[model samples]
Target: MNSSYEQELCNKKLETILVIDDSPTNLEILHDVLGSAGYEVLVEMDGASGIEQVEGNPPDLILLDVMMPKIDGFETCRRLQANPSTKHIPIIFITALTEAEEKVKGLALGAVDYITKPFEQEEVLARISLHLKLRKLNLELDKQKQELEIRVAERTSELSQTLNELKQTQLQLVQTEKISSLGQLVAGVAHEVNNPIGFISTNLHYANQYIEDLLILVRLFQKNCSNPGSEVEEQIEAMDLKHIDKDLPKLMSSMKLGTDTIKGIMQSLRNFSRSDGENKKLVDIHEGIEATLMILQHRLKAYPKRPAIQVVKDYSVLPKVQCYPGQLNQVFMNLLANAIDVLEESMIENQYLNRKESTFINPKIRIATTINKYQVIVKIADNGKGMSESVINEIFQPFFTTKPEGKGTGLGLSISYQIITENHGGNLQCISSPGEGTEFLIQIPF
Candidate 1:
């Protein structure tokens, strides 16, 4: 009983083969042979019922008889081979026709091999076993191919992501070094100027007070000593005391104003050069922009060849933003300096070409700011020779520049883009066309 149960379990694990033949004798012979070889077997008569059975339950191999009542084995094979679903099933023709033409025809219709009628049982079992083994090997190869393709796709994606991350890291390091060096230099200059300006401002205040007290004493002397000697009157006339009193106050006030302007400029330089490290601070956005503009004041002034580039500021009331003030200032510096550069280039080009009919006659930069529900938007626009579409597309990429050699490092805009987008969680976009001017919009969330 145990032996019989083991045999049954082994038979259940074997491959299934379907036999289609009109003759009961051939069907019985194939069924017994394949069954004895430990292969599960199913029998059907005629080609139509065989196709129906194959569709319902596909077998690993098919044994088809050539001569049948309705459709012949050739037609059945053709139909099976045409279907993608059951096309892979190996079909072997069982026919008595010995004509070489007939055999070739069967093979052409997608038959793998043929068995002559009254065939040896051993030959039938051998062919079925061989085809079943080939089918199993083919299925495994297909599965392995699919698995390999999936792994290759995953690895390629991982490499692409890693490359992008490496580029971002490199960009951050370069920008940090550039900003640090520039900040140190500017901060040093501001520090050196601070003491002298402060001293002058303090002395100006006291000088103004002393001049007022002396003027009052002179007025009292003039009122009380009505009969003064001629010598005193002559000395006052020669010295021009009245003129001194009138002009001295004005001169002192002008000197005080000049010192105050210097102090304000120094303070702006210091603010622009500040480094915020890695922390965010609540700061006035406008103040940072003002500081950047002050630093670039020399570039904005009129030169021998070009007129002063007009900067129109249309500012809106903005709430203090929590941000890296120094980094944000850097972005402003790059954008404003770029605007100035483009305007100067346009002016120089026009002057060189002697083109009085140029559209950029008066180079101007307009800076506007606004706030929305989710973010702050700052727009800087310039009426210079605008960039072409192709140039605009590649402008944000590292080391892309339109300036001549030795004029630009080609990293200003690229670093600014990273600082705004990656560091601040913001966006920087450029809009421009030929002869129209360029505008860059910077948006940062509150």
Candidate 2:
């Protein structure tokens, strides 16, 4: 039986216990009992030294004597309990006092167990073993809690990183979709322009040939008429030389003007269709607005049944801005398109309806660009049905749109905001009131 018990003790895990007492005999006895029970023991002959030892290298449990010199066990326990570092260490009071009041007082002072001096050896072992086991369980619980907290923190960090990545990806997708839509719109416009340009080009060539032939005939007549015979001069006068001179010049001028207009339209289309990825360059802000306007020209110059919106260009002779021209062009397109939509809505709702004459309200879009010391500001304003304060506030928020169903994707302003702020380090703002129209101000640093 003794050998079996010895084997069991050897199998037990090692636990450290501190014994504090003024009497060397009591300290030695406590150390031997705990040590034989498979606990590693430390003995202190003074309460002050014992407190220092426990603080420096905390043990699993402490057996403290109630009466000691300089400092008593009660005082030591109080001090230990007060210190956060050593407070959780299980403490037992070993005193000569067998009174219930003394045990109660020790317990009140944060002692986990109380043992009377002149105690039976069996009772001493039982209490010491129980308290040591409790200390072991507490240490294990604390270790598991610490590990759990670390895991939770790690998971939270990973989740935050994933969320940020997802947001970035969503923003990128939205921008890509916007660009694709713009490309498709450009292609459609190019197709529509081809028919008018083809015919105008053909007509101009024929008209130029006709003018050349007519000029040759006139020169021949002038040369011959300088020294003309009477018969030839009489024939030219009868054929109305004055009428030909007057009518021919007017026809040439009209043809030339028509050709020039077609050429201008084609040039605008080419500028709008130019592929977009280039580094920063000195760009004329007006050119960006013009390109955007060309792309929206079809929309603006629609049937007369639709309101004829007047585009007022208030461009200043500003210095060229150092920026990505294509991105700025996109910003212009979004702003101008929004302005047109607003103006169209206003025309539909004729607020100035009580006039004597049935005069159509001329909606107006105004674009202005200015240069400051270190930044360029582009403002696009529209005299149309404006927005409420609440609507204006959320205009830049992602997926927010004022248009009716199936009319808008709601990513235009939001993506424009991100491109200006995140990519170009610029600012986009709006000023609006209900019937007073709206203005968008975009500022880019040089």
Candidate 3:
């Protein structure tokens, strides 16, 4: 009893083999050989019982007999191979028939190899060990395959995300270049306009004085010598001298006003296009906002379809801020321009629906500014069809836009957001909802 217990304990540490056969003599012989070779052998007398034993307690290898009572080894092998849980277990067929056709049939039925009826102890042990090693190697390969596939999937996702970021960076560079080129062009145009305006303004001042002196001389002559000659009187009446004397001064004043307005516009253009290079400068924040509004004046004028969009300014006195002047101007321009666009669209919609009388109030943009010790705040609000919460969430994302495809490049707000948050270390926030209107709040450090 002690020897049997010790043997059982030793077998527990060895590889287990399940042998299925009908002949007790063959089972006993094979079992003794496998047991002596350091393998734990399990025996079953029939194919059905063997299948049950395998399901109840799995083993490392299976030995099936070719000739059996109820079910032959072929049918048994087929049954085990058909089961998913048993399919991977290695099966070696034991048979007495040495026919080539019979061997081929046994191998085809998923048996790893055939053991002749007169079992060679060495051959049986060797075949079982070889198939066991192959099974272990296959499991390892499958695990490695799974790990490689997971790694490949993770790498693909990372690369895809990187590709999208690169695309956005490229587009942003293109946008920056375009803005730079446009600024240069605007600066050049403003410079050109300045010269012509200077000439007209200077000459108009002298021309006004000269015309005034000539008028004064004529008045002196008319006052001192009323009857200088009949020809002079006739000429004065024919030329309508009184009307010219009164209207000429007013016309010159109007001309002067017109030139002054043009000069102001040119100055605003120059201010808006001022490039600050790589350095910051102390600048009037209000000046930047004014310049942007001046540039967008044409869009604010009363159109045939709608009344003029009103801009109400509630500016608080603010000290000059040290910042990138050109970029700050760009942010203001983007925000104001977006407000104008939305207002214009809303106006058109109102007119098309003929709701101007009831629903559409005057389209207006309200701009307010305030300053504290830590930061300066600017607010731009418009009464227009606003965005949903979902849209507001993605507003700062590059390439996100609501404008029609060709009408907008969708870079303005994203670039503006970067300029405020990343460039100036400022904060930009939006508040909006459907049909309620939209408001953008900008806060910049002192």
Candidate 4:
């Protein structure tokens, strides 16, 4: 026998059979028949006594006799089925009552089988064997089902853990790329600041030396001007004092203008840099945009092939928006950079053709912003060669770039979309077609 069969057979043995009958003759016959089949026999003369015996020590199967005094076999079976501990034991009804209706009643009351009087010993043995086999099969199925459920739960937990790890790895890669882009932006800003500062330093030194000369003349005038002196007048004439007086104010004004330029550039740099703050801030959207433009100004400079790209700003005064300024600046940088690159490519093509009046002769970028009742809208449009339908559809997919392999990581627009839509509650959309220019529309809630 298989281990499964041995386990059930050892545990439930088929060794003990209980006989309940009022007639002594019937009881003796059953005892002898069951005993000859290598089973131990226990007898109860009444239904109540049989129930008592079964409750004391539950058997794998019970042989119940009907039509007994006090409580009947049906009542005994009902009592056994009521207890949680004894409910699963199979009950077979053995009765002298030949009425088919009585047998049906016994079976309906939780009896597994019904044996009529004048039953053959071989038939009794065969029916008992069948019911025991059915009982054992049910136990095996239940055990297997529990084991399958445990395995499925373990696999599900492992899959969930792996998915979380993948997401973490993706986030790390995004941050690394962001830092690399920031370095390029900083270099551009430094170049812008260096131009004005360089001139300011030289102008201040010249202004200081001019002041020393003027002061010496004033000292001479105060000390010796009570009496007229020919040499003093001669010295003033040689120095061109009148001309110095006339140009001194203009020099100071020029210096002031240079200082103001440096200050504006520094402020723009601060605004762009401070946007990476941990907390959201109420900020002037236009200021953030101007800062981004400043960072990108170098890209708009004229080259031999093309004049400077014209930028038309149509800004509407609106309420300040609460947002992560640094992140929004990143989105602006991405969109504007793409526009400038596309325009440059077109300019190169136009130069090669030597068509001074080509369709994209003077490439232009237009930025317009407006506010409705609940949202702020920004549109950045470029008059360069526009994208095709396929390019537009896939633009926001991660690592999907049209630029040459090393020139573009394809993550710019995709990361920008994540910043606007996921980081802040906003929408970024692209509008373009072949031979037409491209427009990026951004909307953020108030």
Each candidate's lDDT (Cα)? 0.89, 0.82, 0.89, 0.81
* Root-mean-square deviation per candidate: 6.5, 9.7, 8.5, 15.2
What C-alpha lDDT, on a 0 to 100 scale, does residue 82 get in candidate 3? Answer: 92
Question: Candidate 1 clash total?
Answer: 0
Residue-level lDDT tens digits of model 3 in 1-446: 37887687666667899999888888888888887777789999998999999888989999998888898889988998999998888899888999999999888988888889787788888888899999889989999999999999999999989997886686568657866887889878877888889999999999999999999999999999967899998999999999999999999999999999998888887788777788899999999999999999998998775788899999999988989888888899999999999998887788778854525659999999998889999999999999999999999887889999898878889888888888899999999999999999999998
Tens digits of per-residue lDDT for model 2, 303-363: 6456567899888788877776666777788899999988877765663563443244677
**Which ranges in model 2 have alpha carbons more than 4 Å from their true place?**
1-168, 177-210, 215-249, 301-306, 351-360
User: In model 4, which regions exceed 4 Å deviation?
Assistant: 1-244, 355-359
The best-first sequence of candidates by TM-score reads: 1, 3, 2, 4
lDDT of 4 at 444: 90
Candidate 3 Cα deviation (angstroms), residue 329: 1.3
Instruction: List, residue by residue over 165-278, the lDDT tens digit for candidate 4.
Output: 665456447854674466457657767876768777777878768886876787677677775678977887899877776777677778768777777777777677663556
Error (Å) of candidate 2 at residue 85 is 24
**Residue by residue across 257-278, what tens digits does model 1's lDDT show?**
8988888888887787678887
For each candidate in turn, the TM-score is 0.69, 0.55, 0.68, 0.54
Model 3 misplacement above 4 A? 1-157, 355-361
